[model samples]
Target chain A: MVDGIVITGAGIVSAIGVGKDETLRSLLARRSGLPGGKVGLSDLQMKTILGIPGEETVARSSLLGILAVKEALQEAGISYTGTAVLVSGTTVGGMDITEEHYLEMLGGEHPELFRFHTCGSSTDRIAAYFGGFGSLTTTSTACSSAANSIIFGANLIRSGRFDVVVAGGSECLTRYHTAGFDSLMILDKEPCRPFDASRAGLNLGEGAGFIVLESSAHASSRGARVLGRLDGWGNACDAFHQTASSPDGEGAFLAMTKALEMAGLRPEDIDYINAHGTGTVNNDESESKAMTRLFGGCVPPVSSTKSFTGHTTSASGGIEAVICLLAMEYGFIPANLGWKEPSEGCIKPESEGRSKVFLQHVLCNSFAFGGNDSSLLISNARDYE
Target chain B: MNRKVYIRAAAQISVQEPLCEDWMLDPKQLSGPFLHCIDPDYRQFFSPMQARRMGLMFKRAMVTSRKVLEASGVECPDAIITGTALGCIENTERFLDPLCRGGEETLSPTAFMQSTHNTVGSMVAIALGCHGYNCTYSQDGVSFESTLLDAVLQLECEGAGNVLAGAHDEITDNVARLMEATEPGGYPFSEGSVAMLLSAGESLPDALCEVSDVRILSRREAVEEAVAGYSAEYVMRNDVTFSLFGRCGSASGLAVYAAAEMIAAGRYSSVLVVNESGSNAGLVFLKKV
Candidate 1:
């Protein structure tokens, strides 16, 4: 692991909690932070709303992202002098403000608000706080964006370009996207139930997650404690439809297979699978088929933490990657909440949170519209043992 | 890092022309408040149903990418990467214009699905049945540079033989007016798509140019200091592109397209394409093969 793309530090803000300790506490308690799941719709939003006290004007996405990035850099002991490149993923930049004020702007009231609508604006805003990064970019492949950012950051290091990279994504909820999913008839009235036969759809949520990725040499030289290694990543286009996953999950199978191949690990090496299960009929079925295909019908412990945080959409990939690290760190498998029953062939997720099972390698899946599907494999620090 | 990456082929649909390098000889002199990319006849590429369902941006991405792959003699690229500032603004408008007027129940699934930034990239992959590395970057003006950098990494580090990279954007009448009212540059908002097939190791006989390197920098001062080192024979700045094809996020990508055309025609031995958004800059180095 010391010669791999090791993650030195990770931070996240989700509906469940603001940081690692609180998130792990909530997960161990099997508490669902989603709005529709045993809570009011708008009452249980983000875990902590950032007023940041003395911060200037910035989008909520950037605000959340800044908080996450600060915690991550602090943990990694990264400062402005480290010359770390930042690769952030975000789909809705300032849409939360734009959608709310578009009509008024048409009448020439605060037209400057339109400037913040670009997805890159949020990345730039986040970078501005670090006094400027060595380099920065934004990825926006829908829901799988954050996963792709991590993949791209790993590539940058593997290519011998940068020593340290800050990779993750942030997203804020907006009425426009919520209604968009609702228009597709995919928003569940109740909490979502992934891999369950009676599942309806996903509930929308918002948050940000970030991880400090450093070349193993860079991390060791800086004396930063390596949490885990981002062993493998694969991104493939389903190419089946704009929004719907193929019935056979062709893209998902290919992605998982590629990740396994890249990691030089067999399918059986994976201790757990963090599924993309959006609680929709299409996703759970397709993901199950992919898992069955790749694992040869003997799938590992499977669950979707989206069951807790709802579908953070673009941010889910990064958030869940952090969740995977937490699971490996805490030696537990979080329960796939909201499941009542399963179909005949679908993999049944763990019903209750389990403790004392140290995960060696875990796979995380994130699928998005336009057939963008990505998978990442993270291995614990047992590599040098 | 020692691998030689070549621009095997390039195609673009813009104000000057569509899928042709004829603009190198007789460039179009066009001025616009909102310059829409000219679309060629789609009867040859897509079916009636597809043409009806897809918006202008999708068709542009498909046509340009298809044209690039064909010109490069690549049946299917190992990866398809694209960049766009606004995903599908037309479809987004289609979904939102009515929603603003009628609160709920008037949602268009088609519009909503195609409104994402990756839809164009996804459609291109579907057209080619390419299941390889797929990505989309939306980092404002440097979106396309981000894509080209990824393509470079895929070829050099990931052992990919060929990569199809492109940048696309479409300006709507509404967004054009908004830019005119807000943005200080009277450069006129515009739209276009530029796609190139990049290959590693050996160069093809008819390759357009060699891509030595590409970079995207956050600070303006760093770019200014770095430009002195390359000493390219010719440089195409943001102002030049702004005047040529109006303004769009992918205009920097268009500069890459234009540089390739110039190098292929022997106009310049080396060209450095530079574009900046505020202090951020994207640089693409191209040279005659």
Candidate 2:
């Protein structure tokens, strides 16, 4: 098997916190960031909302992404030199800005505001901040975007292409997204409860999460402190529906199964699962079924962190991946906040709550609209011997 | 061990015309500053209800994917992978327009649901009932090349037999205006779709070509290193006669175009094609053997 890609450093900016340490602290404290909505979009306006704090200065999405990337770079202890590939995933890039400014443009004034309409401009601006010029790309696959970005970055490293890559995803709350979810009738009126029988819908949140990925050789050359190694990843499509997952969670199951198979591990080897858990009725049910089918009665401790941070769309996977890596490092399982009781469909594990077990392997899932499903397996590099 | 994948059937729908036997050989010149696909009659493939909800890009993707499936004689590919630079821009524009106009009220879900970049791939899957490995990559010009790389990987690493891989981009009125306004030096606004049926173990009577290698890069040195790493014949190959480059999007398509030109000109029996997007490049080496 190929030597796994090393995640030397990571950064995060979420409603709960601005950096990795703060995010971890919030998780341990069970501090949910799903309070009064911001960006002029109130909970009354948006059926379900998870607004980011301190939204006055930076563009919510760009701010979160920039801060996260900066922290990641600092954690990696590598100065930005030479060409750096920037692969970002986001479902709503600058939509928050465009949605607001577009009105000004249509009002017969301030036509200059129209420039933000191009989703790529967000990446360009972010790249400009870092003085990066080698290559920059963006992926917009709804919810699974960041996971795909991570997968793409891993492939590039495995293929011996780039020396380093900043791969992650960022998204900010927007009136457009709020309206879209409201229209779909999937926006919860209160904090989202994943896999809860009375779960109404998902509460939309915004944040950015980034990981500095480098080849094993590059990481060792720099003496970087490797948090975890991205051992295996798999992406599969259900081809079932546009907005809803298959009833049997075929895509989710395949994605998880493929990820485990790629790592040459059985389902029992997984210690914890970071579920996509948008808190939507369909998603929770489908993901539960998929877990049941894959792990059977001996399912590992699975939790949906969306209750704490809300569903961040494309950024969900990236942010949650960071949480998983952190949990592995700390040897703790983050609680599934707002999970009062498991839904009827849920397959509970033997462990009642977060275990103090030494974490070896972790699985993260991100399933998006259009039946896009992705799973990533991360493990401590030293475990492979 | 990595296994070589072959592109058995290729289809394209662009500003020129739909994928016809003659269209690939003959050329069509577009007159307008902005380019739009000479859209095939989508009604022929989809019903009014389904067709009504689909934007121009979705229609083009469905039409092209169908044409490719027919050409390959494979009803459902084992995997479907797609790439789009700016996916479903029309729907996105539509959804954004009213929200921006009416203060987030009266926004339509149809356009919003269809606005995501993977809509085309999802629609293809829904149409074919192919619940296989489906993915959509959106990294600007390299989108298609990335999709091709993943399809090849599915064959090499995932043991996928038949895969449908392609790239598409569509031009919307707002997007076209934005392109002209922001990056005028860039290629004119264009819309098109291209799909290829890929497989391992050649079975066709005269297989077009077998993909030998693929790569993605961010820097010029990296690109050069990748090219050199392959120790591939940079200039003349014994069998490469021509190469085809999709040069509209950055020089990303140049590598592939050059290889195809060499093969097509009878200078070589095989060819290689490369496509790149904003910061990523993809190389597909096709050998006659």
Candidate 3:
């Protein structure tokens, strides 16, 4: 197993909470961050309780990314040296502002907001906000973006390209996708209950999650605290449907199998599985099938934390990784929040609130549109030592 | 240094004619601020039904990927990676227009589904039935370079055989106007797709050029500082043999084509392709072995 790359620090801002501590507090308390009622959008008629804080009147994707990066760097206790490469992932990017000024360009108003419309604009903005960096880029693969960012960051370190890299993604709830998903009939009218018999669809949320990844040699030389080891990661394409997973979950199966092969571990070694339970009818069934196919006899305790944060899409992978580290640090498994019954032949998730388990190895899954599927295995640093 | 990566074959579809031959020899000069692709017979790649649903950017990606794979003589790649700056912006705008004016109910799932940044990559994979490692980068000027870095890592460290990597970007009328207003010095926006089939140099005996190194800097000024220490005197001897597109927004993959052309012609044993934006630059070095 490749063991040189480790996560030194992580920061998350979701509907559940702002910082890691607050998010953990809410997770331990079994709190649901989904809005209780319909929250009005600025221009569109749709009303979904997107995880944005009510006080964030000026909530833009780039601003949220900057804020999340600040928290991560602060927790890592590292000053801005402009040495680390920044790899950000996002889907909405600056659409929150771009949508506001779309007509202004046609009217010859030439507003400043149009500059942030590109996918890379958010990453560049974050870099500018944080002075500068050795390099900067963005990975945008729908929902699995940040997960791939972590994978790419680890590969960069392993390839001897750089010693330190900051990798994550930020996405904001935009009317563009909210309306789009509604057209696809995937947004649940009420709060989503993932992996349940009554599972309807997902409730889209917005936030950012970033982790400071450094080589073990680099971290130890600097006396940095080690959070967790990024043991392995895998990505695969379904090639079945554009927005739907295969009935048997071929993509998810290959991704999980590849990740296990990379980490040189069997299915029995995994202590927990953070299922990509999008609460959609197709995703839950397919993911459940994939898990069963891989872990026949001993299926690990699996759950979807999307129940708490309303499926942050691109940021889901990053947020879930941080949650895994918190679980390992505090010695507890996060509750699945909402689940009662399970589909036939599928293992039930840890639906009961706050299961106490000494976790060692955790698997986080993030599946996105166009059948883009990814899995990450983050192990406790102590286990490796 | 780790194992070197090679560019087996590369192809592009730009404002000029879509051919892997000497199209760049005497390129058609742009007459207008908006430079649209010269467009090939896309019907040759996709069926009528499929073509109707796909966007122009998606079509460009499909055609370029096919040409690249044919040139490389590889039918199925181990992995597919892509990068795009303005991914399906036309479709994005199409989906956003009615939603902004006519509310959320008046939307179709087709435009919305095709609007994702990764759609181009995923579509290519789906068509090829490739279920291997798939990823897409969208970092504007460095988007294509990011994919190249991933391809290199796959070949050198991750134990992958052949990888198909490429970039696609299309500027909508609205985005062109925005660029004009925001960055006046920016070139008139253009749209195209560039694809390259990459393999490990040790395994591919028929490779065209070896990719020695790829460097990405956070600022344009750092380009000089990074290259100052390099032994690039060979490059300095070559005059302005190629005319740059003149401040094109970010046709990053075009650099690979230029570097490969120089290596193939035996003009220089090594060529460096550098793409610079205001606050960023992506440098790729190619050597003929």
Candidate 4:
């Protein structure tokens, strides 16, 4: 088992499901959560569980965050310890709610909504909903926001700053981002095919995913069951384009390389890769190039669950991370759905789901706009021991 | 882990004179409920083509970063980290106003592309072609504090020799009015940017000041308890710059800048910077090098 920082629990809420059990079933069944071409979660049913009054308008990001965080805390058996920190990643923030009332806000009405307009508001709302946290920080690095939050939380624990940190991100679809991505001509109206030759673009989704991380000393003292170990993480800037990745995938290559180096693992050791395949032609091709550059023909079973979950934007990193952990804990490989035919020079992903094989190491990638690319290396317990 | 972090250089574009420390000599008294940065001629640093597509917030972040790098002579920092609450607000409004006023018709992608919170920091990396660790924090008052905390860890523990860290936020008319009407009696809603080049103390031959510890806590935390263990010369409970610099999400950078200015001028050997947003509070410790 990993002898250091370990993941005690993880929680997720997406179109696929509200918790890990539901998500696992959907993944193995190859169910597409993109119900009828749109990526929307039913808020009425989710809100009933939130306990907030129906009249009060809570940001969708915060609502999803609370659901995920509550499940994570419950699984981790963590009580209300004020010293536990919360590092949240959310770029949508309250924009999901505020965008509807934008003009009213401009007119100085619905000013209450203004408080949740910033990117940090959702994190604050979640922390407030769950009593309080010792400290809170929010990362807003586009889609990688939540991924970077987990990295920051890991750094906090490694620095001997805190015993535990709740790290992940939550994002909800908004007309703001939908129209923004649409105007950029990157969104595909049809179902997205991540690595196929005809891969067009991504369908945006909304959800939240959170994981409870604790130091080895703390977990052992509390007799916590370690789900997985956060072996390594790396964040790098492409510096190539504001929104486009380099043709060589230099940033993605560097991020993956750094993570592998940190984890002290060779490329061949990784059992699977959760690709940042947003189905955009540029992204799939570039990420393949990065994988080729790093893995050099021996790339592992890589899959992009975005085809199933519909590119959750900021939440994809955390959601896919929990997905990887689930695959490792169980013995299943999530199929890279929507792949028809792979283009030349592009590595062919595992087209079908496989189970009953023990996974040792897994890598998940989340690349964001502005070329903020990040990669995480997760390892199953008992391997190192 | 105990390696001391040092501030090599500090630069700001605020209500005070841009590209200079005129605020220390003759501090500008904010005269309105909203204040804007007295921008310098960006043409000196940015070509017209480079300046054309960027919004004001992007320009301010770039100019301040250029200043920080120029002062420290560090062409490419090991990491570029920043904090911004309302990222690219001007662009956000530019993209939103037309669409919200009408329908989803004729929405431009330029503003939308530059509207992400990480745009400011990532643009710096693109300009310098420095592909290193890059991040953006978007909390409220503690945005800058969060960046500083990351920078400290980078320098001390992560083997990053140097880092460019800062914060930038701009208040638009609608947002300013919203803040004014909602949170009355608060500092004048303002716009500003501050960048600091930081390195470990032992690695740098000379530093402007030293940053030792940064602690973030809930807003419910008492100032005394937050600073109970640390001994500092200037223990700022609430940051001392809002009245002068006005209130911005990244205003805490102004506090750190002000603290560094004081340390440089031999006014204080050590200083504490505290910033409390609505939800959480951040405390930073700075000492004279």
Candidate 5:
């Protein structure tokens, strides 16, 4: 009924790599981008931290995002000439810089640090960098940021507002995020083991991912290679807690259920699920309960890619979506690293380097801090053929 | 598949004192470069310990959401959706202050944890324990309208009976100073939160208005597209009386303001309000039953 919004191209820049191919290769090999110590921190308190490493070429999030979008546009074979860009999703957005400048200003009278207040201004910079100026938008919905961006982009296409749209999210490592997670007592010093009985908390990661989506007609006319079809998406709020998923994952359940319903499919029609396994005790358990309620005993092969890339926060869904497409394209399933010994009443994710049956339909879940939950359904483009 | 959704109850906290009954429709001019909400005593609504951790933006959002819920007489809503151009700016500023000033040592955790843009909506959920569908949208000017659109989608596609949808934007010294330095020609700095209780059916007698449709468009084509897509003649025939325009952010709210003005002048029977600030734009049509 939607005439199908096709994902013609996708790109990703994570702690692992700066392009889709590099990221996938790293994920397939079970490589970790998490360093033993933090980068760019000079003080002793900053030691013993792990994150993605980069320099002043761009803000960490923006750099990763730009790398991803570059690859995505190339893969789509579209030149960035006056295209519409919509960058939706959440992040501290220049808070990394803002925090640094606030200190510098307090210590002395450094006037150069005032540029970070233009947090959302980075979207414009990205768009301009890509030679795009049609319409630019940014959405900040916590973890579900990029997923919501994708949904809004698709809606714009369906509404006949744009010919081509670039949508996704990005987040970068920051001391502020680390301190926040630490405050909640949810920062795991060890590599996060999602859904593990002994699971403790999430290990923060940073990256960006994006997809070039176009109307099916537009894609076909340009002879662009369609990676997959964005069948449907749904978003819901679990009006439950500030930082915790509901006991039953009501919001997650509704988002997934509604997405499938909109796609005109059922649970049996799904082949795999990319879970929002943040390795946190609360998230894994609640998401598992929600999956159980929705799929009953017939839950499909499920895994959380967060183990490989760390929790990318806003970019989690976008990166996961790219992984789903790659799985469908290559006929393989990436492993969920650090997952072992499933928790009580939870399904165990496929171990590292375990290949699954040929995937046809994949569901990706992205849940954020505000109880904002979003689910996206991606299926092989050949399915409709 | 287009369906009608009505705004049964509404609450707003703004510089004009829109929340209190005594301040109805009495517009106030903002004197300073920055205009903050005449905030109600949030202490009465939230516990100090809980409030101790929340930023001013989240506190305002919680208070406004509670006011809307109480006015609507709904113990729990089916969903909670919020939109904010700058989410938890105060918290972000607070979290960064110590790290920058104290050389990244002895930093506080509370500010960092609550600094994310969705904190307001998340805190609202924690306060209510509703366990329903809750999401936050942070798309610049159209943040609130995007939230409203999602609420409508819930009603039409997901069978949501009642939903709480709202938008809140707060002004912080950091944000105000930055805006002043960067974009000197932008609208005066303002902070406010508005919430509405939306129901599927005509369950309330005093339902303020019904939302007919909502739209988001590019600034370049907004006027032409709005005029073409939404005909003044059609609106006139449908008994639309006025429109509320959000002229602050590139006049993205102009469409609604024009519609509200028309309705207020008795030129039409219904009205529309539109707002666009930050990075997004939205239009909402209201029909008087």
Candidate 6:
């Protein structure tokens, strides 16, 4: 088998918490970040709490990315490696800043604000803060953006392209995105209930999540501690609908099956699954069908951390990857908060968090609009020779 | 054990004349502040209903992708990857303009639905009915190059036979005015869609060129060095310096197309193409065998 792409560092910020510990604590305590009122955008006023604090005038996306990168580099105890590539993912990018100054920008009052309108600006700012990266790029495939970034980073390493890659995604809440979602009628009136019979839709949230991936050879050479292993990743497009998933979950099933095939693992080998349960009527149903089809009658225990942090969109993949790391480290499976009854084909999510089980391999799924579906396999590094 | 990737076919729809076989030989330079793409007949490509719902960028992407696939004789590709700096900006602005003016009450859900970056790629997939590996990238200047890198890896490392990788960016009136004001002397505000069918097979009927390698730079200092290294390695003896440096940053795929054109015309055996936006940069090495 091919050597695993070892994860050496991780960082995250979300509505649930700012760092790994706080996020994990919130997950274990079954706390929801939904604060009963309108957050950023108007008209969808059901008390969805926007997690970012009002600390700086800079774009919230850049701030989140910088914060996450800082923690990841600090944890890894490395800085400014020459051959490093930073493949960041973001959906809204600097839309937060642009939306705040849209009127001014439109009136030609502030041309400076115009530069921050592009998605690459946030990624560039993040790279600048870290001195610089030799290679940097951004992926924006809706919700699966960050997961695809991780896959890109891993491929860079596995293809003998680059040894060190900082991969993840960041997104900040914006009135533009919120209103768009509102226009689509996908925001929940009550706090989101993933896999629940009464589930309405996802509660939009903002945050950033990232992990530092290094080759095992490079990590050991630098004496850096290995956090986990990125065993496999796969991405597929549904080609079914622009916004809705196919009834059969063809894209989702292909993504999972490809990831497993790449990892050289069987369906029974997966210990747990972090499902891409967006708490939407379409997503929950489609993903549930996909999970059932992939694992057959013996589906692994599953949960959606979105129940705690809300759907972070592009950053959800990165944040959930960090959550998976915390789960493995703490020897626990996170609870799928707000889930009461089982939806169609989905096995009942673990609403009660479980701990002290010997966990090994875990699968993380992220499906996005436009049929962009991706799945990642993360395994405990200690299990590898 | 390095696998070679070849560009089986390349197609582009840009500000220049649409689908002219000899466009580059006598290219039309953009003299105005804005350069809108010369669109092909939409009626021939999309249904009336599809055209009614489609935005400018989405239509351009579909036409470009269809032309490229037809040119390559590829009915279905293994993967479809795309990148766009400002995806469906016209639709986004349409939705945002009304929402910002009349609040959420006047919001158009159709415009909002097509605003995401992945919409163009998905629309193409819907037309092709390709349920294969699909992704979209939207990082300013390097967006297209990022998608190209992913497609290259898919073909070289994974067992992908053919991958359709493309880029599309449209400049709305507001965005074009903003860019014109910000960088008065830079390349004209422009819009375009470029697609290349990349294959790992040993040969093709009319391979434009072999993609030797591609590198993207985020650091200002590293850009020169990386470009120099690749140029020295691949295009040392080549004479032509095909460049669009200060041109439209968002339409970085133009440089890739230019390089492929130079190689395909037998003007140069190898060409190094460079594109930049702010501090980010993308470099491609193309060689004809």
Cα displacement (Å) at residue A115, model 1: 1.0
Share of reference contacts found in each model: 0.73, 0.50, 0.79, 0.78, 0.47, 0.76
TM-score of 4: 0.97
Give the CAPRI class of candidate 1: medium
Which 10-residue window in model 2 chain B sums to the lowest lDDT?
A: B237-246
lDDT of 4 by residue, B172-286 (tens): 8888887776577766789999999998856454788988788888746565677767778887655367876888887888889888878988899999887765678888899
Which candidate leads in lDDT? Answer: 4
- TM-score for model 1? 0.96
Docking quality (DockQ) for each candidate: 0.67, 0.40, 0.69, 0.69, 0.35, 0.69
**What is the C-alpha lDDT profile of model 5 across B39-121, one tens digit per residue?**
77877877889877666767777777887789778878987877776677777777676655554556656666677877777
- Quote each prediction's TM-score: 0.96, 0.86, 0.93, 0.97, 0.82, 0.94
Task: Quote model 6's TM-score.
Answer: 0.94
Superposed by TM-score, candidate 2 places the C-alpha of residue B30 at a distance from the truth, in angstroms, of: 2.2
Candidate no. 2 TM-score: 0.86
Ranking by lDDT: 4, 1, 6, 3, 2, 5
Please give, for residues A1-385, the per-residue lDDT of candidate 2 as tens digits.
2365899889887777768888888878877888422223332322222232443323456656776787888898967734667778876776776677665555545454444544455565566567664666676778998898888777766766577888888888888888888989999989887877778899988888889888888888878899898988888887799999999999899999989988899999998899998888899889989999999988888878777788888888889999988888777888776776657886542223464657789999999999889999988655633
TM-score ranking of the models: 4, 1, 6, 3, 2, 5
**Which regions of candidate 3 are displaced past 4 Å?**
A1-3, A36-59, B203-205, B233-250
lDDT of 1 by residue, B153-187 (tens): 99987788999999999888877766666685567
Please provide, for model 1 over A1-385, each residue's C-alpha lDDT reduced to its tens digit, 9 standing for 90 to 100: 1248999888888888778787788899988887542212121132234434443446778877877888788888887722788888988887776777777776778777777888888899889877889789999999999999999999999988889999999887877788899889999988888888898889887888889999999888879888889999889989888889998899999889889999999999999999999988888999899999888868999999998988888888888999999999878998999888976557788867579998999999999998899999999876423
Over the stretch B1-289, how does candidate 2's per-residue lDDT look in tens digits? Answer: 3455777766667655466535446555434447666777776788899987767776777777777688778899988987776677778878888776674656778888998888888888888888787777766666666677777767765678889887777776666655555444434556667777888874444445667776555454566556555554443321121112122332232234334434534556654444433444555666654
Better of 4 and 5 by DockQ: 4
Q: Which is the better candidate, 5 or 6, if ranked by DockQ?
A: 6
lDDT of 3 by residue, A267-378 (tens): 9999988888988889998998999899997889888888888888888888888888888888788888668887664568889645556778889999999989999998
